[model samples]
Target: MIAGREVAGFSDREIADLLAPLRPAAPDSTENATRRDAFADAVWSCLVEPGDATAGVLRLALGPAAALVALDESDAVVERRLTDAGVPDPSRLGLAAARARWAPRAVEGRLRGAFRSARVMGVRLVVAGDPEWPGGLSDLGAHGPAALWVRGDPGVLVSGPSVALVGCRAASAYGEQVAAELADGLVSRGFAVHSGGAYGIDGMAHRAALAAEGTTAAVMAGGVDRLYPAGHHDLLSRVAARGAVVSELPCGTSPSRWRFLQRNRILAALTAATVVVEAGHRSGALNTAGHAAALGRPLGVVPGPVTSPASAGCHRLLRDGGAVCVTSADDVRQLVMPTLDLGGDAGPLRLPPEQLRVLDALSSRRPRDEAAIAASSGLSAERVAGVLAVLELDGRAVEGEGGWLRGRG
Candidate 1:
């Protein structure tokens, strides 16, 4: 159902296992001699499949296919972009049924036309053999994207143990603080921060990781290059510069509320654990937490003051036995750090006040100018600029053509 079509019998996890081998060879990965032999075998299998839409989708998704093509007006309601490679034509059966009502050339024309700009676009297609692919998401199986249009770096996907922190987009000030503090503590302990890249807690996680000069991952509902919520463009650009912004959706695609629903699944599955800093009763962050529970991933909720509506969902999670309450970064790391065994105990982590001042000027999703940093942190432009230089040297901040942003180290 996640592919916008039905695939009976096989669970998503089973499907993820089937495609697990294809990750290293992401969409843009180059084909080699061994790969050629495999491709030949896969396509032939697709072409020879007994006539059926379910088999058609499986064939396109697995091998002997380059894309699944569907005709549509805009990128959002993708009619199809099914890539099925075969020694014989795989489209004959499906096209035959639909063509009786439409034109055969029109069907073929649609596939060819979509492929035209798609090549220039370099739609990310992670073959089973690509490097830099994240196998964690393969757990989603048929529900996962046929291939991800990854922006930033694929290395970040599997670079280290990651913890996703999500919350309400309309987060309270304390919620934002928890998000930032959680991110800071996570990075300090050596876990890469991951989130949906939304406003509120998600944005704060990215910004905090940058402030800490630690790696962070931003998962998107749309194309990585497009950067939805256009307001976060600058913050996202910083993420791309420092860590990565990944998307299961292809480039040129736009986000929808429906897509956002599934996007949380990808976010939840990709990390060692998930932490909800704040959320209202219906916040998407809570949805993400539910996905984590269903997927059997560890779920943590940050406790907030009793009065805030933003923390209500978290309180509910605690009440329902859905999540464990985490009051500090130590609580989070104790639950998820063993997978990578970061050994954060080698020494005490430290950050100078000068660095903190610079970081104080940054937001989880907002950038600040030298003057702004000075005013907010109560330091002189000269003083703030000097501290920025020191922070950059320390790998805590970065200077760019646009301005300084929390560096994603």
Candidate 2:
């Protein structure tokens, strides 16, 4: 059989069966993928497939890249190794490094259900080279996902107006309060709230997003099939039922040391903006913050009591000029969507670096072409458009015969 044989001839389920035992033990990581044994034969079947392409999908579907990531290899290094081993560059890491890695894991019915949940939650997939792949992830560089397995209304990833809320696992009252409130407000105002499904701040954010009846996504550390921090399984399931719970791994693969670090890159890459509610100096939340700032995505740090250790990291980020200080959900709202401010209820004035440029470009000039806007604002076209779209929708700017100009209304 050539690489063109229909996969229908070979059940993916069967390949998945063979791959199950290939799982290299994690660093005592999430073990959800190890719970069953029915998916091993499928792995062998996939490896021995008649065609190269079908055989390739078998590996992509199994996510061996994730196992390599767990071994501390960068996506670039991993891609090279795969290619050297004759593994085709599938997606996410077609060339550049992708963040998510799929260590060997089990294939489970629950994960199959996650595929169904994309439809159930109204989310859609953004394959590696898909036109709709959000450019924001370019910030992740070699640490982005090989492909984003998404859930939520389709196109939400690339379209606009999404922000992430992340923080400490041992959240304080203030941290939880801030997270829930901000999540609710952002959702109510039509922004998608993305977060890890950990306890403390992440959980509060997801719950608040749901309560506000807004779209939310959970970027998991493990495969979407297995919920990490198992206590939140119900919460995660509810989210999968309504929104998307994404992962970079194969359905049954668990998250390991390298996987979690890479997963943080996914959380950072997926959103145009990232807000850190509370974290300690060594906090993993800080990892997400690092990716956000490095990628030049809007980075925010919510203020907390000066005395709290949780707030220590946020304060450090602000002091280092690493992030803007955010007091309320409104601040996050502005940093991610500056042009679309609603004055009355609009709480604070923390603008992303891009918004400040648009304001500067609006001097007594009649209007400006996008190129001039980029030159004047010192922001990239993609960055400015992301900001401008929010501004236009918020009635802050108008597209006239002349061009994009500041609007009085």
Candidate 3:
């Protein structure tokens, strides 16, 4: 049996067996990993807390397996290894402090037990460099997760452009409705919806995406082996079926306030754009919006009633010029796919308020009667007729066998 270094008393064979189910299948590489590398990564995942920059620096320098071996060495040896690897000693904590923080937690049995529990629950780990890992996560640098605990199609995590729709947990009815409609519209337009899978707006986004048969990922604060908030268990299970339920923490790790704050970075990193559907003055969704903005990702916010306190955060984002105002999925698409020309016109298609409202009521698929259009647009029949005529002349509206509908222009 191969001797244990990080995981004392455990044989290499035992470590390999525990980690086999969680290893990512490489898409292009021909070489297989030695058992030690995989096990060391797993140990590193649970050894340090999430977003530990010092640990990230060491792993980047000495590599994960060697870093584990260096854990037991003297400060002189560790500093030499750091020098040889060209990694500067961390500023936040010295080598001794870092070792103190990591060594006590790197237990052999703890790693084994967590791996076994995850395997039993169908949870798997996707480390960095795995084909299934999201390439966007690399943008986070040292703050990124060491490995992801996933429960779903790992491909969906990075398959296409992802939009994160997040908002307050104690959401208002108006907020929930907007979140659901935005999620449904985004999915219809081929964007995967991502959320924290909490209550209120987050829950609404996930449910709407699943109802529309679109993919949605839930970036959880805790481990994938157990669902948090207890009530969202059923909803998140559906998310895992269609997209993914992912966490940076290992199995058996519980959610904390700090973890929730850190989890926001993953939601931002996984998506091309982040939209805050609704938020109060100090909502957690704003934290996510901050991360998105810091990453230079496009930020969007849905405008709510001026008087509603729940929308205070969104209004703040808009006023601060930190986010663009997005009213519909079309607006969202423009933020992500900026190169696509939505309206086929020589110049910007500026329309009167009534014409714009009527056009919004019209559908691209089925035709609607004049009366239906009038009711939907909240306009009088005479005004509707007048606007329809103006739109039709501009090649923006069409009359079909049924009645009237949207045009190709």
Judged by lDDT, which candidate is best?
A: 3
In candidate 3, stretches whose alpha carbon ends up further than 4 angstroms from where it belongs are 1-12, 24-35, 89-93, 343-409
- Output the TM-score of candidate 3: 0.79
lDDT of 3 by residue, 325-366 (tens): 899998897666443476532322334546755765666677
lDDT by residue for model 2 (1-409), tens: 1012112122444333332332222223423233111122222221221112332333444443233231344556655656665556634433222222222222344434444443343434444444556666554433444455554333556554688999999999999998998898888666889899999999999899888877777887765667877999888887777777876554445667666776787788788689999998888999988877656567888888898888999999877653667787677776665554465555334455466556435423367677777765557888877877876776667777778876644
Ranking by TM-score: 3, 1, 2
Per-model TM-score versus the true fold:
0.61, 0.59, 0.79
Q: Which stretches of candidate 1 lie over 4 Å from their true place?
A: 1-127, 338-409
Error of 3 at 251 (Å): 1.0
Best TM-score goes to which candidate?
3
Where's the lowest-lDDT run of ten residues in candidate 2?
1-10
Error of 1 at 180 (Å): 0.7
lDDT of each: 0.63, 0.62, 0.80
Residue lDDT tens for model 1, 52-171: 343334434544222222221222222233332322443443543432332332333343333233344433334334466576665555354444545556678777778999999999
